[model samples]
Target chain A: MSSPEVLVHLHQKAVLLLQDDANKIEKLIEVQMENLATRKCPLYEEVLDTQMYGFSREVDFAVRAGLIEESAGKAIISKLERNLAQLYEALDQKSQLL
Target chain B: MSSPEVLVHLHQKAVLLLQDDANKIEKLIEVQMENLATRKCPLYEEVLDTQMYGFSREVDFAVRAGLIEESAGKAIISKLERNLAQLYEALDQKSQLL
Candidate 1:
C-alpha cells in the first residue's frame, strides 16, 4: 500500500541509519585505544574484546534486518576487519614509542 | 644520526600505532551503539559525545606527534567526523525502531 516515493524514502532512511551506527562504533574504538594506551588498564582489553564481538553482531544485524545486502555486509565487515588489524599494529607501535 | 632504514622502521611503527588506536576506537563505538539501542541509557549519549571529543584529540595528537603527514591527518580526521555524524543518525534510527 506504500507509494514508490515512500518506499524510496524508507530505504534511504535505513541506509542512513546503518551508516550512522558504523560511525559511532568507529569512535568507540578510538576512545578505547586511548584508554588502553594511557592507562594500561586491564579493562581496556575487555573493552576491545567486547567491541569486536559487537562489530560482528552489528554486521549480522545489518544483513538480517535487510539494511544491507549480504554481499555488501560482507564487504563492509571485511574492510572493517582489515582496518582493525591495522589499528592494532598502530597501537603496538605507540606502546613501543612510549 | 639515524640511518634511513631505521627512520623508515620508525615511521612504519608510528603509523601502525595510530592505526591500532583508530581500530580500537571503532570497536568502542559499536558497543556503545548496541547499548544505546537496547537499553535507552543516558550513558550511551555521554559515551558518544566523549568519544567524538576523543577522536578529535587523537587526530590532533597524531599530527603533533609527527605520526602522520599534516595533509593525511586532516584527511583522516575529516573522514572520522563524517563517520561519527552517521553513527549518531544510526542510533537515532535504532531508537525509533525500538
Candidate 2:
C-alpha cells in the first residue's frame, strides 16, 4: 500500500504533469495555426491525440491512486475535455480557412 | 494597452487552459499505449504538435500581454517543455516495448 504522503506526492505530480501537457497541446495548436498560415499539412494531429489521451488517463489514475476525489477529477476532466473540443474546433476552422 | 485586471484574467485563463491542455496530452499518451497494446498506428502526433506549439505561444502571449512576467512565464514553459519531453520519451519507450 502507498503511504498517504506518497499518494499526495503522486497526485501533485500528476496534476503538474497534466498542466504541462496542456501547455504543450496549446503550443501544438499554435504550430498548427502557423502551418495553416504557411500552407503546411498539419501533420501534428497524431501527437495531439496521444497527448490528450495520456492526460485524461493520468487524471483518472490520480483519482484511482487516492490523490483526488472522483467527483473533482471528473469535473476538472470534463472542463478540460470541453476546452479541448473547443480548441480542436478552432483548429479545424483554421484548417478550413487555409 | 490592457488593464492590469484584464491582464491578470487573461493570464489566469491561459494558465488554466495550459493545465487543461496538459491533461489532454496525458490522456492521449494513455491511448497511445493502449493502441500500441492493440497495434494501432498512433495517428495523434499531428494533434500533439499543434497543441504543444499553441500552448507555448499562449505562454509567450501571456507574458507579452502583462498577464505574467517573462521570467515566470519562461520558467513555467521551460518546466513544461521538459516534462513534455520526458513524457514523449516514456511514450516512445512504451511504443518500442510493444
Candidate 3:
C-alpha cells in the first residue's frame, strides 16, 4: 500500500528543501568557523538574520499547510538550535582567545 | 579595525541564517537517507517546496536589500542544489534496488 502520491511527493520535497538548506548552512558555518578560528573577520550575519528566520518561517508554513507534521518540524528546529548554539559558543571562545 | 557595526552585524546575521538553515536541512537529509537506506518509507515533501522556495525568496530579499552580496547567495543556493541532487540520486538508487 502506498501513501497518497501527492502527499508523499510533498513530504519528499519538504525534507529535500530542509536538507538542502541545512547543507548550505553547514558549509557557511564551517567557513565562518574557520574565519573565527584564524582571527579573520566573520561575515554573513547581516543577511543571516533575515535569511535564517525566513527559512524557519517556511518550515512553520509547511506545518501549517499540513504537508508535514508539526512534531517533525519542531524536531528539526531543536536540532538546528542546538548546533547553532554550539557553533556560537565555539566562535565566542575563539574570538575571546584573540 | 572593525567594519561599520551595522553592516557587520547584518553580514554576521546573514551568514548565520544561511548556516542555520543549512544545519537544519542536513539533519532532514540524514534522517531521510537512513530511511531510504533501510528500504523503509521516506518522508517530507509538500512542505519543503514552499519552505525551500520561501527561504530562497528571503535570500533574494537580502540581496535586494543589500544585506548580503548576490554572489554569496548564489553560492549558497548552488551548494544546496548540489547536495540535494546527490541525496536524490542516492535515494533513487536505493529505491530501484528495492
Candidate 4:
C-alpha cells in the first residue's frame, strides 16, 4: 500500500476500534438501565465512570497518535456522554422516588 | 516512505507515546511518595488507580490498533504496576508507623 493508503487504513481501523469500545459502554448503560429495580448498586456508577474515563483516554491516545482525527474522537465520546447523562438522570429519579 | 518504513515509524512513535504516558504516572507516584510526610490524602490512591486504569486502556488500544506489540504493551504496563505496588507498600508502612 502507498503512504496515504496506509494512513487511511489505520484511521479506519482506529475508528472501528473506538466505535466498538463505545458500543460496549453503551451496552453497559443499557444493562444498568434495564436493571434499575434490582437494588441500585452504588458500585455501578463507579464502574461506568471508570469505563468512561478509560475510554476517553483511549480516544485521546488515538487522536494524539494521529490514528483518528480529533473531531471524530470527540464525537464518539460525546455520544456516549449523552447516553451516560440519561442513565444518571434515570438513576436520580429512581432514588428520589425511594 | 516504503510500507515497512511507515510501519516502523508508527511502531516507534507508539512506543514513545506510551512511554511518555508511563512516565507521567511514574511522576504521580513519585510525588505521592515524596509527600508521605504530609497528611496523606486518601484521594491520591483513587487518582492513581484511575490513572493506571486509563493508561492500561490506552496500551490495550495501541496493541489492538497494531501500533505496538502485545508483549511490548504488557511490558510497559507491568513496569508501571510494579512502581504502583511499591508506592502502595510504602504508604502502608508509613501508616503503620503512625
lDDT winner: 4
Q: What would the per-residue lDDT of candidate 3 be over residues A1-98, giving only the tens digit for each residue?
A: 12355446546666677667666766666666667646544456534444566667756655644545889888777776666677788877876887
Per-residue lDDT of model 1, residues A17-91, tens digit only: 545555665776677666654645556556655555555554454354343578876776676566667667767
lDDT of 1 by residue, B1-98 (tens): 23445445544654565566556667766676666636666775676566555555444444543445788767766666666677778877887887
Candidate 4 ranges with C-alpha deviation above 4 Å: none
Could you list the CA RMSD of all candidates, in the order they appear? 20.1, 14.5, 20.9, 1.4
Candidate 1 ranges beyond 4 A from true positions: A1-98, B35-37, B96-98
Better of 1 and 2 by TM-score: 1
Judged by whole-model lDDT over C-alpha atoms, candidate 1 comes out at 0.58
Tens digits of per-residue lDDT for model 4, B54-88 = 99999999999999999999999999999999989
Q: How much lDDT does candidate 4 score? A: 0.93
For model 4 the TM-score comes to 0.93
The residue-by-residue lDDT of candidate 3 on B1-98, one tens digit each, is: 23355446545666677667766766666666677646544346434444456667656645644556899989877776677677788877876887
Please give the CA lDDT of all the candidate structures.
0.58, 0.59, 0.64, 0.93
Clash count, predicted structure 3: 37
